[model samples]
Target: MPPSPAQIRSLVTAYLDRHPGEHDALAPLTSALDSAGDPTSRTTLPGHVTCSVAVIDRGARVLHVLHRGTGLLLAPGGHVEAADETLLAAALREVEEEAGIPASALVLTADFRDGPIDIDVHDIDASPARAEAAHQHDDFRFVVHLADDAPDLTLQVEEVGGAAWLPFEEVSSPTLRAKLVASGLDGAIRPVKLEQHAAEHPAPAVRTEPAAVAPAGAPSGTVPNIVGVHLYLERDGHVLLGRRHPDAAYAGGSWHTLAGHLEAEAATAGLVREAYEEAGLVIDPADLELVHTVHMVERPGDDPRIGLFFRARRWEGVPEVREPDRCVGWRWWRAEDLPEPIVPYTRVAIEGIQAGRAYSELGWAR
Candidate 1:
């Protein structure tokens, strides 16, 4: 069954939360929902909702098809069908039908959850042969990651004249291109949680660049960066450090500060959780203060991240290795005489904090 009007409204509401500026532009869609006709129906005049899918490969290229009807290169999409359970299902179905790519070969990015990454409204030319008036299309654009080794394309020749993979910057939609470039996905569909990979194995330092972050004064619709929290606990002239387990995916066997990605929580709250989970230290939210922030790209061609470092003025309990697979041990090191083999960004952050600098950047092009 096609999604209900209520479901469609909910999807738009959620999308609007991420892009409040579009409320006026999307008035047609909101108005259509209140009309007597079904917005999902192609015959519904003036405008109707449609689903589109952006298929991204591991190299971060977007698969675009030469659409025959419009004589334009665009993401695979069309009218929603009764058999489609939701907009997402409709989008996946369109991709499979037009590109010959199976749904099994793709995965949705964790960032948007089940919602469309972008919603675009465009005008469609009237078709005299079909006796159809000119109308608008409310396109709900969903993004998917193609598997690294997916099969070659088999375009539905009748509709798609040809298909090609283009860099994100080359995508036709300025809004879609900006969102994709800001996301810095590099073909990786982010895992829901980093802790899931916390197992004892000699995995190479996770070949990651950095987390997501939306910088101050960023334009609306820019994808936010992956946020993380780092705990800065100090006693006397020494600071706390941990030895990540030798088998960890990231910075294995390296000394680093107690840190973690922010899960549906405030930065300070996330830091408090990491302190207790990784080191068994009890912290009061009142005792924490923002100290430093690192806007860094760990490597070239990766998404940038925003790291929040918080200083704890007072805390209870001794630090211990609570998650052995993530961190094997905890210790203190002097500011002037820190231990070797620390995570590079961790070292930069420590120096900045000591030097009383509130912000630092790494790996960004000059």
Candidate 2:
């Protein structure tokens, strides 16, 4: 049975207090609760949440449906509808609708009392064909299995192009990889680890000379530029910092302030979004005060970027390593005394903040 509304809220609150590490990944759901003060509204956005279920067979082969729209193999699931009474029910319903599998054929495998096995938060880009803005999806993933007496399987013609029972070791989708790890079924046939930074992160060549020519295959007057939004969440004379999962694309194995690239959103909104996504904190734009801006470039032909640093004092939830795949851990460092191996741009911004300076630059000779 689904927990009552009050009980559900209590369960969420307990989960939040106990698993501080899950705050970032669980932010969208929590934020929905905070805004609407109800769990039902979480199924849509400003923050949207969905339920996904991984169905397994007796032979240990996992069930996968080829999504006709995205062309990627994924678990059987979809958006949570109004009629759904609980997240588990929603997961079952999606399995039926997307995979043509009946609820009687499945059994829940994970602890329903412990929220979801995993929650994925990502932006869904808008298409020119669709008159919609980019939005986010917060997926609550569950694991289920075929019943002992269940018969042979079939596929949903409209939603799924194909259905297969495959070994978990063969599932190449990163989305499925994270879910398998969380469910521990990946234990029997461990999935390939894709979070190794050494293979993805590149060490750049140091240079003492500036570029003498335009980038190859570039337009005569066109050059690229980038912008970053960083949070300087401070409280009790300390600021929040996160250690990039040694496998980050750039600056892996480095301590950096909570930051993200600018999207098609305002700087403050992006910061608010990132704070919730990276630290599981709801930062009010009104409470954010600009502290510093770092204009830096890594190499010639590299796009110039402006890092806008904002100090946030008022927010909800304590710091957490929300995106564990991207950041291994989070900490509070005294602004005056920071740890080493900091991202050079971030370190420069902090130094400027401490020195009462406003603007900074790097990777350029004075």
Candidate 3:
């Protein structure tokens, strides 16, 4: 005859009181209460106990198995603490800490059963070392949803040796059930081993370039005339405009096309790279048709600057100020109704884009 529900509850409560801080010892106490069939005899065992269990699922139909060095397989569960106000809190906490999954991500699939009579404690320690251990949990069990298709199991290294999903048919055996029950007490299954290999691998060396010296022929602090690509993207006859951030030194509070200075380090791909970063839009470099390259010699004693403008017929994503420090706003405006206080260089590029000219030879034309 199975132990009465009241007797089982009393046994669990007593056991919990004796093992105040022993998390692993609760397994044996549970096992002892489970095996006691006589209601009168059950009183001999500890009665006070508080523990938690998790019924985890992977949103599928397969069962997760772990090799925890115990002969029996079981679900994931552990003892509750004085700080744990309720068993549900304890159950969710244990699953996350032991399984490395967030509690919020797990969906509780079953109602928690109370009383020791509803629990099972199987003891099957094939190993002599585990058999002699006083506080070893042979296994613990949880009913988790495993799909017909297997899901990836990322095992917590400290708690489980290895984990896998086994078919229900493969697990429905008396011998396997006994082993699973033992392992479940500890919340682990056996891990698979792999082979080792040794091979020759070489480390690469790093290279460095020397600092540059000022050329005697050139003036001091002369900004180079960078040949860059400017994108004049027109949608429904309105040109896309990128508003310069107020903090910019040259063109603060001015609107300009998507453009940047060419970098020698980027080879011929600087235009493609800059267009994407400045406008938060991507376009194929090959698709950019060179609309014009303006050769502008700055006013005497002013920094010399040159600009290359390109028109792209195709691109991806809506324009936005990806770098708020460099650009604060963006909008689409018709060529006839341009925004005020536009930069002189940007104005020249816009004129060329509007005229549909292939090149604009500009030299202090203002």
Candidate 4:
């Protein structure tokens, strides 16, 4: 008999659980299956998996072009390993290992691309005979956003020849000088010109005007803005709750749902990180869903706040209070029997749950 959806989901989940690091290895095959459906239509040969970096600055301009020793310039990226199950993971690992920066410090902007060439092969002599030739490589690229305050970098001497930053105006040059221009290095060479311009021009005054208002009839007020990949973490039909530590600055001695503030550096990634930190559980990214965004103005004396909520049912570890100071304890509670002295936003979120409303937009009257 053909497998039911539940059975198929279970089988796929089980397989994924067993090979946690095989997600990237399986992506091409998954894409092929998505497009062609028939397994026989896909290429069966193994290809060398590799990654490239496109590091953009805080102003969204391309920074230094990481180059190989032979003078070929490209972003920082490389081949995947047996331990890397996904292209993103490989890209992050390569960036940190080769660039000497932490994955948390950089933001991934684009998904891995097959790039300009769909197939790249590197042939090597396997033996003295021509028939014994071997081939390696399939190139991929990912865009990365560097922190605004990133420091001057040191090249990984063995893997990289050197790096140079290029300027926007010089990028159009026809000769190799243009490569230097395009890469933004020429700007570094001529700081006096920029200084001269700065000296000649006066700085603009700061604007204190209120932001442009929305047109009449536009939907105004707070809007729900849920993010992706945080969990609801239900067990035995009861959802979990955590009590804030008495010393917590924001919501001391209050009951609240397991949640955390998303990091500015990595918004999407922060959801997964928060789940792990707050609940002491590891969840698959694919298993989480964005449930709602709750926007609200503070009551007379309370602080104004906005919140994004998410829900997930699957995880690998049991829940616990990881930060004893930030979270004193945790318990499972039914939707009907919520604890008292809850944080205001926490109460709003739980009310969203009980009302079967996915989100709420709240506003404060001045």
Question: After aligning candidate 2 to the native by TM-score, how far in Å is the CA of 305 from where it should be?
Answer: 65
Ranking by TM-score: 1, 2, 3, 4
Best by lDDT: 1
- Output the TM-score of candidate 1: 0.53
Every model's TM-score: 0.53, 0.44, 0.38, 0.37
lDDT per residue for candidate 1 within 1-366, as digits (tens), equals 466676688789989998999999998899889877888999988889998888988788999999898799998989998766567778888888899987756655657645788999988899999898999999999887886555789899999999989999999888788878887578765643322111111111121111332233667545545577889888998999999866555677899888887655777777788788778899999999999999988777544578888999999999997777567888989988888899888889899999999999988889
Best by TM-score: 1
Q: Which one wins by lDDT: 2 or 4?
A: 2
Backbone atom clashes (below 3 Å) for every candidate: 4, 1, 54, 11
Winner of 3 and 4 under lDDT: 4
lDDT of each model, Cα atoms only? Answer: 0.78, 0.65, 0.46, 0.47
Identify the superior model by TM-score, candidate 2 or candidate 3: 2
Q: For model 1, what is the error of residue 357's alpha carbon versus the real structure, in angstroms, after optimal superposition? A: 58
TM-score, model 2 to reference:
0.44
Off by over 4 Å in 3: 1-224, 265-268, 361-366
Model 4 sits at a Cα RMSD from the real structure of 16.0
Cα displacement (Å) at residue 49, model 3: 57
Candidate 4: deviation at residue 117, Å?
Answer: 42
